[model samples]
Target: MELFTVKSIGKVCVDKKGTRLKLDKEYIPALTNLEGFSYINILWWFDQCDHSDSRSKLIEKSPYKDSPEMLGTFATRSPERPNPIALTCANITYIEAENGVVGLAYMDAEHGTPILDIKPYTPSLDRVENPSMPQWCASWPKNVETSGDYDWSKVFNF
Candidate 1:
């Protein structure tokens, strides 16, 4: 097997104020010109799930309310997988370039989670006009904009 090394450019901070991505001083310059974009794709590490056991998990019982009985790790967004990496498209509330802080409306990651990378959310390259999905999830929100108001509780299995 091949090996790779990944370093965190920042960490996620969540508090009463809300979520924020605090980049390392070295990564501050990279945030320049990142403003103006309404959204961004945050690639982060699943710190809590970075265990050997989690990495070995390749399949999972369906985590959705009305999905198949079982699913491969790639099929579901579960953090338990070969590589504990997560990608989330977050709304950019504000960007403090000097402080190297990027305010976020929300992120599925926990506080202190390591940020792998960040990229502007360009619809031309990231958006899919009419992509197909399984019937079970077809009723889900069509876009990230509507996902905020969506009653996700009805879709996720507890």
Candidate 2:
């Protein structure tokens, strides 16, 4: 088997002050020109779920109330995958390019979560039009903007 090394470039900071991505000093240069983006796709580590038991979980017992009784790990966005990684598209509120700090309107990540990578959200490559999904989630929001007001509790069974 081939081995690869992954390093954390920064961490997601969710506090009373605000939600932001605090990049390490060494990665400050990488933030150059990122301000032009209105949104960013954040790849982060699910640190809390990085355990032997979590990693070994291959099936989930219906995370959605209206979904199938059993779902493969990949079918749902549960943190208990073989690799505890997560991705979220967050709206950019502000950016301090020089200081490597980025403020966001909202992010699904929790406080102190390690950020693996950040990519600008370009419509050309990121947007999906007329995408199909399971009937259970068909009533979900159509776009990211409207998703903020969506009643997520109705979908999640937890």
Candidate 3:
């Protein structure tokens, strides 16, 4: 197979201060007009889980309490994966295009995580009116808005 390459356009700034995306100087222009969207799909690297052992993990041993005991890597949103990449649809708190900074309401990424890319969250293309899932997770939140108030600790084992 031919080798492919991916580069970070920015980094996630997560701290006690807040969560934000700080784009590289060269990618600052790319943030133009991004403020128009209320939400954004962030593609980021799971840098902390990029080790060989994590990458080779193909099965997760019940990350969810009520789910099946063994779940294939693809079946669960576990960080251990071959690509070690993650996607999160986060609400935009604010955007500073000139300074290349985007404040976010929430992001499931660690501080200093490499940001692969950012795309406007268009419901027309990204949302599904009705999506099916396993019965195990049937009680999960139906949308991102509702997910904020969800009791995730009850759903997740870890």
Candidate 4:
């Protein structure tokens, strides 16, 4: 297998003020014209799960209620995986290109989480009008718009 070298371009910051992505000074120029996009797909590292044991995990006990008892790492969004990477789509609240900070409406990531990359969320390439899934999650929220109000506590096993 081929090996890869990855570096963090920025970090997520969540404070009493708000949540945002603070890009490195060198990466600030990449944010040019990014304000045109309404949403962005953020690629971040699961730093907390970057240990040898977490990276070696290929299977996990299901974390979703009513889901399969045991699931392969790829089947669920567990932070522990061969690569401790995560992707999240977030709405852009504001952007400070010169300052290299982005205001996000909401992101599931925690403060100080390393950001791997950021991509504009293009509907043409990302949306799926009809997605097939197991019956267990059929009752879950159907779209991102409604997901905010969804009672996720009921769906998570934890």
- The estimated TM-scores of all candidates read 0.98, 0.96, 0.97, 0.96
lDDT (C-alpha, whole model) for all candidates:
0.95, 0.93, 0.93, 0.93
Candidate 2: worst-modelled 10 consecutive residues by lDDT = 60-69
* Model 4 stretches astray by more than 4 angstroms: none
TM-score of model 3 (CA atoms): 0.97
Clashes of each: 0, 0, 0, 0
Candidate 1, position 36, lDDT: 93
**Best model per TM-score:** 1
The predicted structure with the larger lDDT, 1 or 4, is 1
Local error of candidate 4 at residue 38 (angstroms): 1.1
Q: Write the per-residue lDDT of candidate 4 for residues 1-158, one digit (tens) a residue.
A: 99999999999999997999999999999999998898999999999999999999999888889988999998888899999999999999999999999999899898999999999999999889899988888899987779999999999877
- Candidate 3 least-lDDT 10 residues: 59-68
What shift in Å separates residue 89 of candidate 2 from its native position after superposition? 0.6
* Clash pairs, model 4 backbone: none
Residue 88 of model 4, lDDT score: 95
Index of the highest-lDDT prediction: 1
lDDT of 2: 0.93
